[model samples]
Target: MDYYAPESLSEALDILGRGGVTPLSGGTDFYPALTPGGPRQSLLDITRIAALHGISRQAGGWRIGAATTWSEIARAELPPAFDGLRAAAREVGARQIQNVGTVGGNICNASPAADGVPPLLTLDAEVEIAAAGGTRRMALSGFVTGVRQVALKPGEMVVALHLPDPPETAVGAFRKLGSRAYLVISIAMVAMVLRRDGAGRVDHARIAVGACSPVAQRLGALETALIGARPEEVRVTMANLGALQPIDDVRGSAAYRLDAVREVIARMLREAGDG
Candidate 1:
């Protein structure tokens, strides 16, 4: 297999513009998808790009470079609003996967069960994509079109996951239910971010669920319901979960997923605090 590592985004984009090159970062997903003697792809490794390797504040929010690993994210001194993301980072895989898996890779892989998605959605994240022509940005909600599908066009690669600044008082929580405690895919997962005024009323709320839909989805109904309501008064009705399209598999039944989500949501609200 041919391999080329570029030291700059422009250089990488130039190579990608020529076409027929597979982008590689941590390869946590790429390598696993390959079989012995399977078809080989010409790889353009972007991990060497200096610009694509840090987490920093920009445009009043935060910029997490495409090559930044989960370990880096989990260790970064970010605000309380990012707690759900850090929690998701810690649960991405085992310690080794956490050490090597990149958020860019996770989003690009576009797994329905990707732990990174729900938290990012709660953060109102945007994806920055780079190409020889320049760059473009899109909401994380629209970037992952479906299971294993992303909106990236030919010659474009994800450059970073950009998070918009959230309410200073907003705090986040993440919960995933699996048959086992560690190293197991989630049967259902929920992430929530809430900001309450001094009067102890929820003014802003964002809730996202994964493993229960083709893509992790924000619970707009639930979010709207929480607004102006005290945390203890918050309720997740079946109508609130109507947006998720969970399918029955080995993890759990559809009814079970909905039931679990309600429990998870209640716990998450409590963790974020209640009136």
Candidate 2:
């Protein structure tokens, strides 16, 4: 196998623009998909590229580099609104996977079950994509088109993810239902962010559900319904969550996943409100 480890993001993007190269971050997903005679001709190791690592606070929000691993996110001291992401980080896999599996890799891979997407979606995060020429920011919701498909062009690489500063009263929660507690793919997962006014009434809310369709989806209808309603009204709004599409797979049936979505969202909203 041909291997090229670029020292900088520009070099890496140039190589990717040349075509026939697969950009690898942590390789947790790439390595497993490799077969004896796979389509990948060359391995572009972006991990050595210093520009694609680390996390920092930006002017309007926070930026997490594409190479930032789940382990790093799990250990970072971030705001309370990021608690859902931190919780999802711990559930990405076992310790071994967490050490090498990156937030960017997970987002790029675009799996419906990707543990990072729901939380990132709830945060209304934007993905920064870089190419040989320049960089562009795209909303996280628009970046993933379908299962295992992203909006990235062949030459573009995800540089970092930017999360806007959450509201002061915002609190969030994440929950996943799987066959077992650890090392199991999620059947259904929910990430919720809720902001309460000084009067303890819900002021704003965002909820995203994952592992139930080709892409994780934000519950916009439910979010809209939560407005002007107290936390006690959340259960009624969540009942309409059956509108989401889920499918039967080896892990679970569509019917079960749909049911779990409503239950999980309700629970997460209640918890976020209570905090």
TM-score of each: 0.97, 0.96
Which candidate comes out best when scored by TM-score?
1
Residue 97, model 1: lDDT of 93
lDDT per residue (tens digit) for residues 51-98 in model 1 = 889999988899999999999999999988899999999998899998
Write down the lDDT of every candidate, Cα atoms only.
0.91, 0.87
Candidate 1 backbone collisions, by pair = none
lDDT comparing candidate 2 with the true structure: 0.87
TM-score of 2: 0.96
RMSD in Å for all candidates:
1.2, 1.4
Off by over 4 Å in 2: 236-239
Candidate 1 lDDT trough over 10 residues, lowest sum: 266-275
* Clash pairs (backbone) in predicted model 2: none
Q: After superposition, how far is residue 59 of candidate 2 from its true place, in Å?
A: 0.7
| Model 1: residues with Cα > 4 Å off, grouped in runs | none
